[model samples]
Target: MSTDNTSLHLEKVVPEAEDFLPILGTDFVELYVGNAKQAAYYYQHAWGFQPVAYAGLETGKKDSVSYVLQQGKIRVVLTSPLEKDGEINAHINKHGDGVKFVALWVDDARKSYEETTKRGAKSYVEPYELEDENGKAVISGIHTYGETIHLFVERGEYEGPFLPGYRVYDTKAKSPDTGLKFIDHMVGNVGWNEMNKWVEFYGKVMGFAQLVSFDDKDISTDYTALMSKVMSNGNGRIKFPINEPAEGKKKSQIEEYIDFYNGAGVQHIALATDNIIETVTQLRDRGVEFLYVPETYYDDLLDRVGEIDEDLEPLKELGVLVDRDDEGYLLQIFTKPVLDRPTMFFEIIQRKGAQSFGKGNFKALFEAIEREQDLRGTLN
Candidate 1:
């Protein structure tokens, strides 16, 4: 994975500011599931994530179990409650298997909590410490859209497999590395007309700024339409694109997600990769399904995106889409829904010095999504 471009690309887009809080990067994305063990295996075998740590009945007294998976700079915690009628089980019942927390790494957890709460953010967890043999780390959290939370993690002096509670979970399973690097951006699908409210909430509560905006007019097809606005922190380490359904000839994809998800929540996560061609090839061979476009898209792709380093045949054969801006170009492709509910999915992206989102590919991408939703009977 290309880890060298993060600092350079973020510097070009964001100017230094005397903001109240400074976030380092994403610590992890936590998912609440009905079965953490099987879910962990699914990620490792399907997405090439390595098993890192685990917390369950074997570790100690427990009401829930958690499994940590890592690859490159990405870490995901899959948690499941052992008891019925608990909060974790309640969340799983309502939303199915989906993201519950988008944890952010910070330097000072207490200060970050105070700063955000003072600015009217709802508190999810007070600043607390968890100590181990290595050291101590502080953490706090605040509520976000749906039941999801944004946890502020300060690893202070602590150094262990994960937190103080988790132990190393070793396994004999082996999967080839797929070259997925880190989280590029997270997209949230809110209800109708709720996008602007959350965008303003991030601006006022977390001191983020607007990076880009897309309305229904620019990103729409004949069957469905949606509006999105991208928000980023000052250092540009984290980006969240909020989307809402716009009136169309039929139900938009955002509406379908909301109907199935039961509320506003994370729609998809875009993971950055250095070599998407190789990464996707491995993922496809390993049973990961991706959305496909008509061959006609590649016929005029070069004319639209101009010359790219990769040839047209490989990209078209693999069903990858290309887009460009003044800064540079990018190649991106989306996977089909990973869960049974058609709720959460993923995107494999390779950015070739491009600082902006792939705006040019939205029409084709949304049309593919509409096709899927139609088959699922979500679009009427």
Candidate 2:
């Protein structure tokens, strides 16, 4: 249960992050998928995401279709191509239903784009305004790791369901909320020796500070290893952890992701929950598969993380792992890859007070992942 407490969690004041990009929160994450209609159904029924907005032929969109879903503070846009060949189709053909944009909520999209582009960020889209009867919304974008883009969204003047060009999506079917809150963090997997390059990109191009870092020694199993560094923007609303494959006996998860994804891309997203025990239970009941954690890992749980509020029986039953930090302990669990490819997944987390990631559970967690990789014959 013991970990390199000092190095695993950076103990610094929040103000250490620069204020150049004052992010309010995550606006929305847009994913280019093979089928937006079916994907939207899966999200609604399986993940408890309610339909928010829709844009397609009905809304005068000829090339592509998009469906926006939201649960609590988390918003995800599932988009698909209508024509045979286009940018969205090319993205889906290459990446196989992966994230395209990690949009950030900001006050001024124009200023955010200018600041980052001036600081070396390549522009994906210049500042533009989308207006409708509801009001007007301004947005801009910049390229990040791989083909992923970071979009700055300014919605102070808009009152529509989502952005302009989208109509309020109404559905007769109901999907209950799972108590999932905001996005805790999103993880990206890079090519060999590319971790530091993206780490420096966030620091120099976007004014983010390194929150914590882990080498192979900190996050390694018997067969695989990877390096990761967490980056955070000012006000601590946005966090991204960049990971790269380290030397190991077998292929690490980062390497596997890059192999299947064809390049650097988002590997997983961590979603915060107020009550993980209940949320995980609901997700399981709705047919969500999670990684298998052996019961032996919980034998010394109390001695390792000390006393906690939750009953250990339920946590053990749900295969949830616990870890402690200077502030407090947290509970977390990872779901199996939701897509056909073993690339993107989700992490359910509930933090009482701990700001750190689950460092103490890295070994057990990675071992569980290795077991899955073995089943998929990707462990070699």
Candidate 3:
């Protein structure tokens, strides 16, 4: 655990890069699951996401069904195959309910596709228009690290529940809103030496700039270690931190995720909140399990991160970790794997003024993750 700097904050000097494929923001994230209905219910009841739309057999889609849920600006589309065999079914069978598409809201889908494909991206879906009574929306896609895709959605004229095929879906069941404001960042885990490969892809293919990076020396525990690099788009609305396993005495979390997911894929989604204490409390009460942090970690919290606004007891009780950067501080906590395979999970974050990810908290955070891996019998 190296805490050399008195402040222990990682200062960023991100170089500005010219973005060819201009993205407005994240459109939505779609996950291929075994059961869309049950997954939607779990998200609604457990995570306080409100149902927004639906598309299925009754809506004239026979092969698959989808349910869209939203909380703040974050929209999650859960899709399941209705038939016995298809691409969606194949994805569910292989990845076990993980992120399939990370859609970006763009101004022009065709140009976005053209730019990326010309820059060496493999085309998954060509630009196509989907129109209904509402209007028209254009969508295109390109392959990324693993089975995951970056879907470009140009929905400037379309106005419906979600895309053109979905209709307003309401169950009449009240699910209170958790304070999740928007997606802070989404992290992807790659294989043993593939981090730089994808990092270069983002930089060269997508025109994203490197914000910050970490080696094993900055993010290692006694048992395990990993390396990460944060890449952000031109406007900074989108950020992706790519991670890969590093050599250590035992298997690291990145290695564990790759083993379980069977390839490189999204490891976690970090949702931002204005008040982490309140948001985490609601999540815990609603049956979301967070990683446990020992009480001793909070004894010197004030000294490590400097003064924060929230009460120390509440943060310690909730097992939320605090860290500071050159700009400011942030409060964050990691939930245990939301799935059975221990491949994907969620991170609740509240940025006070910090633009940097919690670099100061990496050691303690990875140690907590190692504890979980030990219980799962994967910490070799």
Candidate 4:
């Protein structure tokens, strides 16, 4: 089995001071959905996120509504407008309620915009400063695949809860912290022949490098297949894995996402937490349903991956999966389809020390998914 040699060697790490600016962390993840209210509830109740702020007709914003949810340092915004025909609707129709904005927090939005656009990025939104009574903030955006965008947020000068007109809501009920620290990685699904196109787009346009690559041969089950390549910035703070569907016996997950989402767009956002057990448990008790691996798989967990740092009992009870590499071990779990179209989902990950994605667990994960497909009667 070929392992990620780059992940194993600490000394070979790519320096971050090159073409990229220092990223504080993920500022917010904005999803464009059909209905922001329902989406907000799904995230707040099912994902253990607490309501933070809101914007809608009540706020005099007629075209759209947005709800902000917060858990730990993570803030997610669900946006849906009243209009039925436009870019937002087209995006939701094509992507089946996926991520539209990956807002990155930086020290200076104008500088970040200038640096990236000068390097060849397509400008989505020019740098503009928004302010209220508290302070001011500068935000800019650059285009990514399909209708997706990377928003540069300079919040050093702002002090309001989220943005202008968003007053902090004091809710008596707070969701339990799931140990999630920040956004780990986000994955995108592109067209049939567009994987390398985006890899190069990130490489040449955004100063990202290929962290890992998997051909259809590497990530295929008996019924489905796809190609994937992971791209990361110099600091490895932001990772995006782009995938494209390959010919298969049945409709691949990538194809399903494209079919319902209307085109190539984000497939999932993988959030990293410090503790998998606590995070997943809180999420489940809050109302999240997860994709289940068979109970029999746990019967041979020790034999397959060897003894892990975590006890097998709790892991089996929680249905979390573990894998190890030369660098270190990692624990991860996936949430079931969070959207009606099976297009959007999330992953809660705890990287004990490992940097590599769980290649060894692909077969097991896909098998579990195929079982779901069988039940849904969507398997081709």
99-211: candidate 4 lDDT, tens digit per residue = 89999877778988888899788999999988889688789999988778999887776667787766665567555556666778999999999999899888877677888
| Candidate 4 error regions (>4 Å) | 1-13, 16-18
**Clashes (N, CA, C under 3 Å) per candidate:** 0, 0, 0, 6
The positional error of residue 322 in candidate 4, measured at the CA in angstroms, is 1.3
- RMSD vs true structure, all candidates: 2.6, 5.7, 6.6, 5.6
By summed lDDT, the worst window of 10 consecutive residues in model 1 runs over 1-10
In candidate 3, list every pair of residues with a backbone clash: none
Clash pairs for candidate 2: none
- Each candidate: what lDDT? 0.88, 0.91, 0.91, 0.80
Model 2 has a clash total of 0
The candidate with the higher lDDT, 1 or 3, is: 3
lDDT of 1 by residue, 86-116 (tens): 8998898889999999999888889999999
Model 2 CA deviation exceeding 4 Å by range: 1-13
| Worst-scoring 10-residue span by lDDT in model 4 | 1-10
TM-score of 4: 0.90
Question: For candidate 2, which ten residues in a row score worst on lDDT?
Answer: 1-10
